[model samples]
Target: MGAGHAHKLYRPAHSPVHALPPHCKIAAVLCFVLAVVATPRTALWAFALYALLLAAVAAAARVPAGFLLKRLLIEVPFVAFAVLMPFVATGPRVHILGLSLSESGLWGAWNILAKGTLGVAASVLLAATTELRGLLLGLQRLRMPPLLVQIASFMIRYGDVIADELRRMRIARLSRGFEARGVRHWGVLAKSAGALFIRSYERGERVHLAMVSRGYTGTLPVPDAAPATGGQWSRAAALPAAALAVCLLGWTL
Candidate 1:
């Protein structure tokens, strides 16, 4: 697979966060997201606290500022949708920038924007702290549906393989003077896609056979790993704890 294709997904690192057991980080992220979701939309102070807590976690992980910013932008589209809800949602009218829009819509926008951004931040922080394989192991340990975890595990394992195949196919087509600009090449493109599917299916079967021949089991096992240090545990708990407290305050008052 091209390096560009794998650039953004989790890669292993030697940072403090990376050294922690994946189960702990996964639990913390799940709790943080739930707490953020439970927080009232109007609780601006609570939201700020949640964001700061996430920032603290990121800092402890030693993720670079730009890398973190770039990853967080993945939620921009969702945020944009949330921002637009205030204008299109149905309710009593309010004027903004000379356009009358719904009062309820405005509140809806704020609700999604705050919640979605915080949720994405929490998720990114978790991903940054753990590699994809570790995250999968964490999910497995969490008592998640084994079938779902299996699907995710396979997808993560083969996603790059499929992507590389697509790239090579593209290159071959381009070399053959095929420019996909209009309907003229549509049939050829469709056939190529079908062929790619068949090839991938065969490859998967082969991989499965190989695994079976090598004493394969249904479940992937985690090795006997050392427990996380005190500092790592503290950092993992810090964000979820602060977010929970703030969320409680938001609902109480």
Candidate 2:
């Protein structure tokens, strides 16, 4: 990925969290999330502990609470789905304020809400500290399929170009007094989308050809770098270690 394609989620900083290797951070986040997922949903204290752990990490990373909260809104759709569970789910109904709700559904909703929120928060924190290219590199280092990593890399690199193309097309439409005010304009919108797809495809072909001409191989070249030191691994492992402790407590308690 091009260095110019820095994702909006990354915040440039000199903190220790930011200094850690990308693969280590990726592994840490994955382990942390797995621990959270393994925890029993009914363990309310466990969830609170998880939140506090994340909060500590956020503070250590110097990520703003407002920034985290704003990005956390990405989970709103899942929250909406979970909200309906209590009302729509059947079996073992409980009366609450003259309305009956399924107890199982209530538990299901809590599960979704608690687990989903924690997962998203962890992801947001990861993104906030790591750049898009770093994430792709991390995946590549972690033995992820090269094809998938390349696809993600290209998507991140060219996503802005595609968005800019869309913006220009919209402007051209507006210039021609083509307002998409109703279903009548659907045909125009569909045609525009089709054209965009064709253009993107053609661009991809050209890029591929250029790479082939430049002696491109099936896999990207890995940079020669020092392996992670024992200290670095321990530091990176700390977050997941704490999370695992919480998971064990949740299970045993």
Candidate 3:
């Protein structure tokens, strides 16, 4: 995939959505998610509205349908967890379509699925509209622990390099007769993992040295000013606001 489609990762573009400041989007989207998650799952209309709100945000951000689908898929683990909860959690069980499911547990499961899906969508929009670096800056602005932001900044900086290296290693293994299918094969796989780790460690050292040579400071610094304006907050807020409103309406109905 081209960089644009690669992981639906963030980069600055000329799009209107891309012009918004990162912190505002993060705050608004997070609040929206909390609202959805806090709502009762039996409120089915609320969940539907939450899904629709996510779709609307995608459209407003000009996100391609394919990109949104990929983002949605990333929530599969959460959805799975939610789906399993009803069966695994102890509660009053009822039969649905010839399957036993918990009453309260089922509600809890749906709640998790809705919240997780919405959360993932919100994250995708944040990444789509803002550069990865910009998001880190916004994190710092939002007073996220400095140490955490510093670590995240470095990880984002070198994440692609590490990923590329992994791809090359995989390709090398594939070119050889390494079929990843048996116990014996796993030994070689383990060795390869060790080798990959060593390489990554050496790369990190080299990167640190290079940065130091180039006048590296104690902390990663960013531009104090981002172009996101107050207007952008309003535009982004509209989504979560509507979502929350729908949930309230569901409760009322």
Candidate 4:
């Protein structure tokens, strides 16, 4: 993806977390999330410790609490699903506020809420620290399938172009007195979508031809790797290492 395609989630900073190599950050986040997932749902205090660990990392990264909380709204749908679990789950029930709720459902809800929140929080933090291109490079370093990486690269590169194309189509429709009032307008919208797909496909073909003319190979050129030093790896590993410790305590205690 072009440097211009940097994601909005990346918060430019000189903090330790931001300075960590992208691959290290990726590995650390993966390990931390695995640790969180391995924790027992009944270990309520352990969840608190995990939250604190994330908070500490956030502080070190200079990520704002408000920013993180605002992004956490992305999980609202999951939260809603968890909320309904207590009502629909079948098993022994308990009374709360004079309403019967499944006891097991409550545990399930807590499990979802706790783990999902932590996982989302970790992801948001990762995005905040790493640029989209850096993330792709990280995945490449981690030996992610080149095809998947290239696909993601193209998606990031062209996503804005596609959205801009849609906006222009919308404007053209509006100029032509199309208001999209009801089912009557669906046909027009469908035709516009078909046109957009055709345009995108043609553009892809042109790009591929241009690449072929330039002697493009099946694999993209790999950039020079600046693998992280041992010290940097140690620093990066600290985050997941701390999380693992907490996970062990959660399981044992």
Candidate 5:
């Protein structure tokens, strides 16, 4: 897989979190998310602890709180859906601030907000600490489907290329004094999108043919990433292990 590009989310740092093998961090984040999801919604304190754990991770990763919070804005849509749940969901009603709200809906909203935020935060942290190339390598190390890994590899590699193409197209349109200000411009935008698709498709065909001529196979060649050591695995497992303890407490208490 190509290791030429790092996604925008990656923050270059020299922290321990960044030093661990990508597969170890990936597995740790996965387990931590599972633990968070399994916790009872009523155990609100558990969620607080989960947030603290993530905070500690961010601190250790040398990722500023502002960096993490700004990336977390991507989850605003989920937050919006959760906010609407209290008004739209059907269930037992409760009164607060002279307004009636469904009791179950409130809990539902909390569940979504708490869990979704934690999940998104975890993902953002993972992306922040690991590069796109490292993530692909991690998935490959974890025995993920080769084809899926290849697809992701290609997406990461060419996403910027496509974006650049779109930017250039937009610049050309603007240069011709074309301004899209209303619904009337939808057709032009749609045609532009179609043209971009065709051009991208042709580019893909040419690239594939070039690869085939060079003895391309059904799978991409794997990079020689080092496997995690026992100490590294144990260290990486600490987050999820702590999370598991909290989850069990959430269940038992």
Candidate 6:
């Protein structure tokens, strides 16, 4: 994992949440989300409790409410899809405010909104507290496939480079008074995209060759570190344990 690959989502902090091993946090978030998804949507109160649990994690992590809420905007497309379910889905209808909505669709929409939002919130909190490099390292520690880790590492490392290239291309276009106002400009935009892809592919090839020349192998070297302590594991398990309790209640009650 490269130190140059810090993402905007990570907020630098000295809190205990930030101090915990990256792998522990990753596992905790994963389990927490699983528990959330397994929860019964009919248990509305359980969803509220789940939100509170995440809120507690955010407070421990020193992540602001605004930060979490803003990143949640990424799920707008999912929300839109969920919203349409009630209108388009066929099932028993319930009238609310002069419109007939499927009862099953309402439940489906609620399920998606609740589970999806909680999952996204959990992920946002993880990303907020963990750097991209740390996340790749954590995945490696968790025994994720080396090839997948390498792909993610390279993507994180070069995503900015690709974006910068696109920016420069846009600047060149703007300098030449190329404005994308209508379908006529789509050709130029498509051509620009194609050129960018070729440049990126060529760059990847050069990077690969350079690595091979320098004793590159299928696996990247991992820095040795002590495994998470029992105490740390217990602490990290707290979130998921609480969520599991709630999920059980959701199913039973």
- Cα RMSDs, all models: 3.0, 1.6, 3.4, 1.5, 1.8, 1.6
Candidate no. 2 TM-score: 0.95
- Across residues 112-207, which tens digit of lDDT does each residue of candidate 4 receive? 999999999999999999988889999999999998999898888888888899999999999988889899889999999999999899988888
Using all chains and alpha carbons, the TM-scores for the candidates as numbered come to 0.87, 0.95, 0.81, 0.95, 0.95, 0.95
Determine the C-alpha RMSD for candidate 5 after optimal superposition of all C-alphas: 1.8
Candidate 6 global TM-score: 0.95
- Regions of model 4 farther than 4 Å from truth: 1-3
Candidate 5 lDDT = 0.92
Off by over 4 Å in 1: 1-7, 11-13, 145-148, 217-221, 226-235
Pairwise lDDT winner, candidates 4 and 5: 4
- On TM-score, the stronger of 3 and 4 is 4
lDDT of 1 by residue, 1-253 (tens): 3343332546456777777888889988888899988888888888888878777767777877677778778788878787788778997998889988889888888888888877877777777767776787777777787778878877777877888898899999999998899999899889889988998899989988998898878755556567667877787787688888888999998
- Return the clash pairs for model 2, or none: none
Who is ahead in lDDT, 5 or 6?
Answer: 6
**Local lDDT at 170 for model 5:** 95
Q: Candidate 3: misplaced stretches above 4 Å?
A: 1-7, 10-14, 84-95, 98-100, 173-176, 226-228, 247-253
Residue 160 CA displacement from its true place in model 6, Å = 0.2
lDDT at residue 139 of model 5 (Cα atoms):
93
lDDT of 6 by residue, 9-49 (tens): 99999998898899999999999999998887889999999
Looking at model 3, which ten-residue stretch has the lowest summed lDDT?
1-10
- Candidate 3, residues 32-129, lDDT tens digits: the string is 87888777767887787777777777776788778767868977777778888889878789999999988888888877777777778777777788
Model 3 Cα displacement at 107 (Å)?
A: 2.2
Which regions in candidate 6 have their CA more than 4 angstroms from the true location? 1-4
For model 3, state the Cα shift of residue 173 in Å. 4.1
